[model samples]
Target chain A: MVRVDGKGSGALVEIRSLDKKYRRGGEEIDVLRGLNLDVDAGEFIAFMGPSGSGKTTLLNLIGGLDTPTSGAVRIGGDEISRLSGRKLAAWRSRHIGFIFQMYNLIPVLTAFQNVQLPLLLTNLSKAERRKHVEAALDLVGLSDRMRHYPRQLSGGQEQRVAIARAIVADPTILLCDEPTGDLDRAAGDEILDIISRLSKEYKKTIFLVTHDPIAAKRAGTLLHLDKGTLLECTADGLFACKPEDAGK
Target chain B: MAIPLEYNVRSVFIRWPSTLVAVLGIAGTVAVFVVMLAMAQGFQAMLIGGGSRDNAIVLRGGADSEMMSAITLDQVRVIADAPGVARSASGDPLVSAEVVVVGAFPLLATGSDANVQIRGLSPIVLEVRPNARIVEGRFFQPGLTELVVGRNVSGTYAGFKLGSTVEFGGGRWTVVGVFDAGGSSYDSEVWCDAVVLNQVFKRPENIFQSATARLASPESFQAFKDAATSDPRLTVDVFRETAFYAEQSRMVSTIIRVLGFIVAIVMGVGAVFAALNTMYSAVASRSAEIATLKALGFSPASVVASFVAESTVIALAGGAVGVLASLPFNGFTTGTMNWSSFSYLAFAFRVTPEIVASGLVFSLLMGIVGGLPPALRAARLPIIVALREL
Candidate 1:
């Protein structure tokens, strides 16, 4: 998708000339090469590619979960390419919110506690954290379900709770790795609504990586990737298609 | 920092097999620990209980225990006037000069025989030891060639029962009574009159093996020591009854304590290895969960602490069970050879609070030591790789 509104000009995420490789049993396996991209604040974009296309590898690099062999990744002003271990954890907690396809909510915690996870890094009191969690759940319209556990919720409901968790810390960016990949169509739509609202209502910069074209179609800009390359930029606002797009 | 207990509990639930294996390993360690501690307790109790605080043992000037000492009748008479020696209201000496000997015999129980100490005592002896009781018969006529066997010395060999005759040192002695001496050293003694024993074992400088005297007060103790030691006429040493028993207690307790520590160390090492195995399994299995937690911003320290705490909980559970397992052994009486007496010394297993506490701390330490490596591995794992394990 081409930039239409030119609204989010300042970059929230910037990745340059990133490359990664692994040395296994005395052989080198290259995973990513010369990857370059930028996403400004409040933009929703999708990363689509084949298996091992390095969508996850690139996302891992951008999320500061892994260090790139070569490149710089700046998220909300901090270059996190060289941050190690606990420092990386600290940086990740403050800067990025991740929504996984399986919705990796800690099973031991209740929905409220799951949302409160990232905020544990903040200096907020329990009451303060609770208030923020309530607001986040409220924004996703799951305020009444704050006490439910992950196992107690339906797939869409769990995803919505995950979204609430992602936004609870008031993070700068939302990174979804195939967010709807694990759900049925109806539940996926409900999750997309919540995710779309995160961008539209809270102005969170969103990056969704997925291969299902219908899932990709929901994004404002689609960066179609086949072999780790940005092959196409579809010109459409996030799910800008008519209501019929939800069916197809 | 004291981690909230919920984290530990949740961690156990997440890694149940690892936790169970750790608990079971710790359980085995604890079981052995409890049994050993109980044995020590029983042995210690027997040794400590076998002595009296009011009665003092007077040994030859150079000797340590009655089994090794012999004193003349003159020394006994001299020690009776020692300042702390309690006197009867009838103006008689409250202490008794006794003859102690170990008669060799084959045992009926365990088929392992050892010498049994026989003491020749007088009228004042019963008054000095309140635990002395004639359970089966009246007191023996002291001047007669009659004898009484303490209950512990009875029923272990032929002619050991009440009214059974036995010949010792090629002399005939009639068993006239059986007594119970409330589980002290007196319980192990077969009794006869000093006059009768001196006549039978006659070299009749009227020598006895040792003297046991009752003291009246703490203040008069030094005077008694002076009476025994300062006078060249009395070649002997005097100790407070309490002090003497306390000394006797150390010989047995020190051995029990040292053996207990050695056993605990060995079992602790085994438990540590088990805990290490369980923790590694836990960390390996929960890598994805850990990665997710890391992604959620929990510090590696918190994660490490949670696992260690969980392992400790398992270990503590095992230790608690061990303490309980040891309880039945408490007061379970058994006897072993006392090298000093060349006789079977009886004792009960004691399961004390200090012992249990030390065991628990040991288990906890084992868990912590074992959990550390896996915890570090978990902490250092890349968040991406961990999450990918899901």
Candidate 2:
């Protein structure tokens, strides 16, 4: 786990005592109960936990992808949880860029058109959207593969193209849920390297959820969640709770 | 709003099979519509073309068609002497007392013959109908067992040519010539002399089928009909030639219109089903991708819009195909026998531009209606749950 330098600072994403649940017939399944978190601007924070530990759920709440049942999520200065459907959707589009496990590129479209999908929501010109897509593909080192379909590319290339799509809208905060979960070790390393560079070089805040220690180690801060709670002890630096020897 | 060309084009190409099915279904509907219009037109032609503006069919009172009316030979002679009735230059009244009856001749396909109207006409009937001419060997001799078969009969009934013989009620009528009625009701008949036909049928003194008269003036019709009906000795009615023809075609017209609507509705149902199937399959196949779009900064509304747009593109392609497929049917001619006239009729398919436009609009509506439900499903997906599945 990586360590953070500052102890107190303004957070780009702030979660306040969140509780979430799922209803299966008459019974309720509690996914996250009373989870709290804060992420600062330009920070690269990795969340690590075993399966069913609410790592991704917490990330989703921070990104405004899902609403918390009993608490609030504030991004920048706006309390997102309190926003209505339309307002919440507008906020999400302007603030967050999400990366999922498998690259969800439209199979029939070229990689360039896939990257241009999000920009369609904006009032950008045709030429302008093209320019932004080209620049985004260049950022992911896939400028030449713009016209290729998703099936024509390797797993790494596809993931890179997906990354290009995510960045095309120029979102302030990036949310990645198991971004490397479907890639090989080498491809996973390359993806981690690109994500790390986004936070440090581009000065964008990133909140990533992963089970891989190597991917988690690249973050400037580490958040360890278990049973819907942030552990009290920091591993070595920031929010790391790899209480390995201590728990043993 | 400008949509990306690739977005619309690729979406249609991806769903080609479902698209083709939808187009063909709609095309079948349009074809049905065209054929029905042709049939109605054919029936109308046979009825209207058969009537001569200068001539009229005087039936007995309280009756419509000839089969339901009864006129005595005395009344027929007295009506023929009326001042309104025209006369040939030979000074003879240009009128003929005709007998019309429905009889059956065995058909090749059905094994049992359908009821066909047989008319016994005179040379004066020919003079009244200028358009009715003998295109074959000759007109039947005035008084004999020989008869003239109409153009329609020659085409539909085998052995209905000159020198051929047909049996009716144990009496063999030899066909002497095949004549064309120039697309009139006469085309449905077998023409024999009225006196001989009445004698053969043993109804020499009475005839239910009325007299055909060449009128002096069209305006004299009301006076002529009033005089004849009030004669007490003659209870008969009169109608304008066009009005009579229009009424005759009414039943077949109604039938064709109803069939056309049924076909259109059925086609609509089929196209809607195709649209639903395509959309449902599209949602299932693109669930993961759509979820990813929803998760990534893209709002649920945008994701739904994207999918709806894709489906609409497919529908538009299908609609275009259907419209093109229906184009060739315009002006295509087909033949059928009119139910009221018992005459064979040929008419062209009246595929108007407006019907084609409606077909396309209907297809688009099907797309919108079918796409809405699937779009809602795409919008309702939870990002975290979707990512977990992936």
Candidate 3:
């Protein structure tokens, strides 16, 4: 078994004094303000907050899908927050996978083809690609349903397929936004269990944003946010604290 | 990396109604383009196919058509005896001094009167124009009020059937035969003895409209032209038969071609607009999907290419349908007034492979023009905003 050390000195994702702002009709709205984080490799961290708390924005910045207004996001020591446009896209494809609340699988593709999408960026031969896709689907326990399209699968199954697609390329990190927000309690539990297994068994670094406490409890560490500031969860209650204050 | 092409194809199928709208619009445009060009092709073929490079025609100088030319009998003889003129088995020069006139004929289909060409020629016409053959009956006998009508003229006009008599030129003439001229412009004329026609029409006794002669070989035409023109007695212009027919087809064919292009362009604009609207709607409906693809690391250029490819496939399918829709008109006979000859000329619609190819090329151009803006818009969509859209 691979050992997962949450406080390890080797940090895979490091964000320093990050800020993100949006302008709406001359109003500069600060979405993230002076946020700093360090997530070690193989750590599963979840952020829980109310609407407008900038959880998704922070997730976007870490995944290289968006540039911060200032400061830097470094993944494996490379400053990715400065990358823009096509360069950022290439970086994200190689290093990050995203799972949305709606299970955003391409409607036209079957589950196997959906999982095979990320592998196309690689130079793998067709046989090798097929092998990778099959393995990913089998890992998600959807081996019997490879040919099913998104419309044909239940919500839980679709989320599972999304998970399979996310990890098919073995990306450095998985960024999920409310991955089970659209599911029932039973299906949501199943999704969280699968995510937990991926974190524990496969040593995948995961950053998840969710409103449900049950979903947040699956992560190795839980952080809460209010008014664009992150707070660590403690046994007593959630309070504004630095990354070092966690596990105190 | 890009989305697989099959994704775009399946998306098109998933939204078939909008796809069909663009397809039918482009199909209609291509059909109009193909049919119009076919008309010009058919007309050009009719005139050009009748001409032979080894034959030459002599018309009065400055006269643009045979109907406007008048050659005196002396000039005709001089042209017949010109150097390089071919000789028949009987040692006679193979030349025909022909007279051209026009008479109104009642159309069998429309009952409206249309001007038909009446050509008066000598017996040597058979030697000079070897493509003309009597299909139903014998050729007209000389010095009688007998005439032969072309197959197209016989089929389109009333009272021109064999064994029938028609009143014209202040007298009645018998339709002795029906001749086919191998799809040439000659198929739109009536032929009778030149001497009888001049006498009946009250033209000067020794004057004919033109003289056509077979040269010893195609190479002899330049010598023949120099010799015929050097004589001070003859004020005439000379041309090889093929060159003359091409000149005759120039005006009408140009008009049809220009009009076809204009109509196709106007209709093509409409098609482009239709395609643009369809693609915009496609992008709008697939906004979240596009965002997902972007989030998955597909370059914006790939998305643009995917959409353009889909539009092109739709346009090509429409072009094929347009070409197929035009097949029924192929070889279908119709008649129009020849601008140069000032007489009715019958021809078939020709749908050549080149015409079909041009139609497809035109459709492809429309697809590109129509697909571009929407594709650009799709590529430039803000990923975060697009993802948030329902």
Candidate 4:
């Protein structure tokens, strides 16, 4: 197994000395402290950690949703941390897709419209958008349920629709934060299967944050984040309770 | 990229109770604005319509209205002989020296004493005011105590109907005729023989209040005004009748407009707060949705525009309903005191296209003012914090 300590060759995402801090009434809390990692394209990396371990914070920085307090984050050679507001948004639309645990689909829009959201940023014709949306929905095996709204769809189905939305724009990277945290075990596995397929078949660079080890087992590489520090870990080491047996 | 309009529309209905309160609030504000301004428009229209561009009115130089002006028969003669005074085919000047006075009359509906204008003019009154016609009976005969009531006066005041005897100016006069003044402010007056009215009212027979003269041409007004004012023997001012009436309407119309705006603004503030509450509630309730949209790379401007558009649409709907509500009041006859004449003038509510358009624009302004703060708040919401709400 390869480590992700900023030494990967031809890495698609590079994080160097990244730090994030929050101020809480005269107290400065360090969420991420001098975190460094490198991830190559098409890698399905699952990040398992406790609450406040900065796993989601790292994903947010990589996705350009937040800026690190210190150091640089470069994705595909573009130093996204330096991008201005509108530029960062444009970069995000073009490159990053997000999937959340709650299946954050707009309640008002149908499944098809939800998937077509990112495509609206492009200058594609309406028919072209329709074609892409249908293909993405079909990939999630929800082609027949395109017209159903979020409330009409079941929990697992809503997550699948969210997955369709994430992939419809064919983004370069998928930043999924606890995408299956609210789901049953079967639904969780189903979401992990789609995410694994997205990485393998579409060659999408995936960064998944999850606490479920069974979900993390589907990843090509598994890492543990403990107190804002990242370390390589195996599936066997994942289930161990002892502090020394946790990660290498 | 812009957010889809369908999203905002569905959200509005999905949360309909608050939307309804906002809509009704805006609707009430617009309705009040429309009705109040329509009243001003109607009063101004009636008074302004009473005068013709080709007629000139001679009044005392310092007087603001006929009620305040006093012109003797001798001065009227000089005014009639002034340059640019039109003449009939018989070579007589088309002038009518009139005495204007206010009489207290019992209102038919409320039985309260209200002021009614009484005009005493020469028999040539109909010729000078071509719009006035005997709609029900013949005009009053000269040198007689017969009275001819205007259509509005006969209908609004007690004992002013045709053939009814009414006491005024220390005499019992018979209502022998009813005239229509072509929907002008003159509809609120009564006319009788100048000599008879002066005799009963105890004024000097030679004294009159104003003289209305038809001009040879509308362009002859300046010459007539110069001629009347320059005459040393006559202490009088002359104005194109249309201009005089337009000026007379200014005080009442301005008061109505100012009062209307003050009331509308007062109500508009409440409407704005209602809109703010609705939008803030919307933003708070949709925090997760907003975060999802932001994460999808919808710009802050797009989010702001979407929320503002929703508010504007709601306000526009309210405006449409308000306009519809005001339409029924159009041409519905009502009366209010004319400050210049100091008498009740009957006129209809005039909801012109311009007034309706102004109301809609006013509501649109309210929507923008009310929605902007909440929209900006929604736009500036941090994506991570809102996502955590999910």
Supply the global lDDT for candidate 2: 0.73
Q: Give each model's clash number.
A: 10, 3, 0, 0
TM-score of each: 0.85, 0.73, 0.91, 0.92
lDDT of 2 by residue, B1-390 (tens): 223546545765776786566556555654555555555655666678788667777887777777777777788887887667888889888777888766766544455565566787666777766678888877777778678877767655666767888888557889888777776667767888877777777776466477888788777677677677677777788766667778877887778878877876777677677777777777776677666666655666666776677666666666667667666766665555566546444444555656666666666776676677777787787666666565
**Which model, 2 or 4, shows the larger lDDT?**
4
Residue B72 error for model 4, in Å? 3.8
Residue pairs in collision within model 2: A235-A240, B61-B235, B61-B236
> What tens digits encode model 1's per-residue C-alpha lDDT throughout B10-87?
767777776777777787777677667777666556555655666677888877777667888788888887778888
lDDT of 2 by residue, A1-248 (tens): 22222233356666677898878899987888776666778888777767878887777777777788898777788998888666776777678887877777778889998888778768899899999999999999998999899999999999899888888899988888788999999999999899988988898888888877778777776677777766545555543344231222
Clashing pairs in 3: none
- Maximum-TM-score candidate: 4
lDDT of 3 by residue, B1-390 (tens): 567988988998998999999999999999999999999999999999789998999999999789789998888889988999999999999999999899999999999998899999988798898899999888999899898999999889988989999999997899999899999989999999999999999989899989999999999999999999999988899999999999999889899999999999999999999889988999999999988888888888888988898788888888889889988889989999998878999999999999999999999998899898999999999888898895
Candidate 4 regions off by >4 Å?
A1-3, A8-10, A233-248, B81-86, B89-91, B230-235
lDDT of 3 at B89: 92
What lDDT does each candidate get?
A: 0.75, 0.73, 0.88, 0.89
How well docked is model 3, in DockQ terms?
Answer: 0.60
Cα deviation of B176, candidate 3, in Å = 1.2
Q: What CAPRI grade goes to candidate 4?
A: medium
